[model samples]
Target: MSSEPTHQNIHTFDQATALQPAGPHHWKGQPGRLYWNMVGPFGGTTAATLLHAVLLHPERIGEPAALTVNYAAPLADLPFVLEARPLRTNRSSQHWLLLMTQVDTEGQTITVASGTAVTALRRGTWAGSELPHPPVTPAENLSPRPPTAGLAWSERYDLRLLDGDLPTAWDGAHADDSLTRLWIQDLPPRPIDFLSLAAMSDMFYPRIWRRRALRTPAGTVSMTVYFHADQAALAAAGSGPLLGEARGQEYRHGFFDQRAQLWSADGTIMTTTHQLVYFRD
Candidate 1:
């Protein structure tokens, strides 16, 4: 055997999952890699960490059925506390409220973001769906997107754009084709879990960026997701480069609504998500 040592790259998803418990209701967060956005940590990762805080809570019950996160303020790249409190709990479901806060030199805690999640004990029953996964080119046939020059967070995912380009280069061939499809996976490929899946669900860039090729100031003000898959379904996907689609339905009054869906490689609808974004002309 050759005398060479081997190194394994860890997915950034796991790096963010390494939150340390600080107390009964709080955990510490650490920023990693190109996880930062134009102002702070990527919203997806921030949401994932918040959900993670709930998962680590001893009082948590069942799996996540729905989650809503509000980007109240920008997050600094310092140690922050994730406070997850169960709003209520019953035999079948539980609701939790989450907050991300930072302590200042004066020993005061500051709230940066807030979220709520619902976890429920799913039961076996007849399932039916009228929604179908959108047809797209198989991910294996498409090459990975070239990394965007300045966006560090973009490098964390292997995204294959099937429908639209960045607002920078709009061919204008299909102005009405606002639908954006991407085959995305962790940079190094990690198993699909609630945490990773939650982050992937928010991986779509702003819908306005694809609809109107303008460099307008836009951000997701609030996001919500409803999960349809359970732990077994997630495990069946293994380490997947999930197929995702997003599009804008309406835009007015400095805000727009976008809908997104994440499907497993086998065409299972894993999650359905929607977000309200704030935009300025």
Candidate 2:
């Protein structure tokens, strides 16, 4: 961890909602507030922060094509260090490795997360999406989802649940299917960017919680995302809500796999993501 002191720039509350850059290859996570989850900081924000570290790096090239983040351990509420390095660079693509660690007062560094991201330059090529957009209530037609009592992170996004029930331990009717479709955007409306979209990819609740009627302890172990669009695409999206769908594929040995897709207002595929989660019954 770089001993560089924290930078003095004061980011807007919304912009720095997840992380603030302290120096080169380093950042300070936001303090306790709406960003908090039941345990530590939300995985979405942590993922975005890792990507953000890459985005801010001067040595980065092209745009993000893929990202995979492994949650090695839970993070504390204190400031943490983010380190990003370009592992390899090809003619049209670049590969990066990232690590987020927390240093104790005694100067012991504990890694909280590690990730890999691929950025590549894209040329005009034939492209198409085989999957049709899932039919669901339009953002304008649905009511705003109310935030849960203790989950302050829920308030950060305006989520309109169009299908599949939210995971509640006592709700048996929706336990069998872990599917969910919603229109989501950051609260108060912030421009769509790689940082925001990374967080949005993880906006869905854990699959185990949605599939089982009982709420057992659950969290993501690793998450991966592939960006289908570039910066211009995200910029065009502005702060508009994007349609999101997520579901579980399998469950065994206290772990399950979940995958999700994000679509723009015009049905353009923006991103696809997958994750493995751990749960205790």
Candidate 3:
């Protein structure tokens, strides 16, 4: 038999975001070109990698409840160090601090990204969702979104746009609002998990691209994802497409904020994300 890796069915997302243990609280990883963006690896993969480090921690408790990632600088395509530490662990919750750093060409190690995460032992309680799922055509009825030509990261997910696509004109005319609704899932159909959910949270394209119709430079500075569903809920979601909705709240002074929510076909809100983005004028 030919000598190939045993796990041939491993999905590309998992391989791209994989990390290896280096020390008690450190891991080593390198960026993969499959998720490369205009500048560096996709921010979603970065966030997922950071969270995955915590999940792989031996002392980890419960499931992810919240995660906030701040991109400090454009990550270079190089081997990097990941440090994850549990700051506090109580009876019901745990807090963590994470940092990713890489050595620059000048031989100085600098931070590229940092984040804070919370995992908790979920307890049953009375709950209700005030924001009902948006009414839209089912995923089966819509055609798959055409692949974005140059961005490799966009190809990782199968997207079916329902509304609010990129502007047809580039004349700097601003739309009245920035809103996009789409169905999204891993292209090769990986099982739904916290790590995958974390990545999917940052899947939307910059809202400014659709709002102003201008191809201005834009990047996420900070992003936060709040998990509304526990492990069982996520498992139930399987590998099916999730309905994702994103809209911009405000844009001012070269910065804008976006809010997005992802829901299961059955109407369970899996996660909600908010992010602050930097853009060029």
State the lDDT of candidate 3 residue by residue for 176-263, as single tens digits. 8888999988887777888888888998889999888899999999999999988778888988688899999999999999999999
What C-alpha lDDT values do all the predictions have?
0.82, 0.80, 0.89
Worst 10 residues of 3 by lDDT: 1-10
Stretches of candidate 3 off by over 4 Å are 1-7
Q: Give me the candidate number with maximum lDDT.
A: 3
> Top TM-score: which candidate number?
3
Model 2 off-target regions past 4 Å?
A: 1-32, 104-107, 167-174
Instruction: State TM-scores per candidate.
Output: 0.91, 0.89, 0.96
Model 2 is weakest, by summed lDDT over 10 consecutive residues, at: 1-10
Model 2: clashing residue pairs?
A: none
Better of 1 and 3 by lDDT: 3
Q: Can you write out model 1's per-residue Cα lDDT over 163-188, one digit (the tens) per residue? A: 87576665433366468888988876
**Model 2 Cα RMSD, 1 decimal:** 5.5
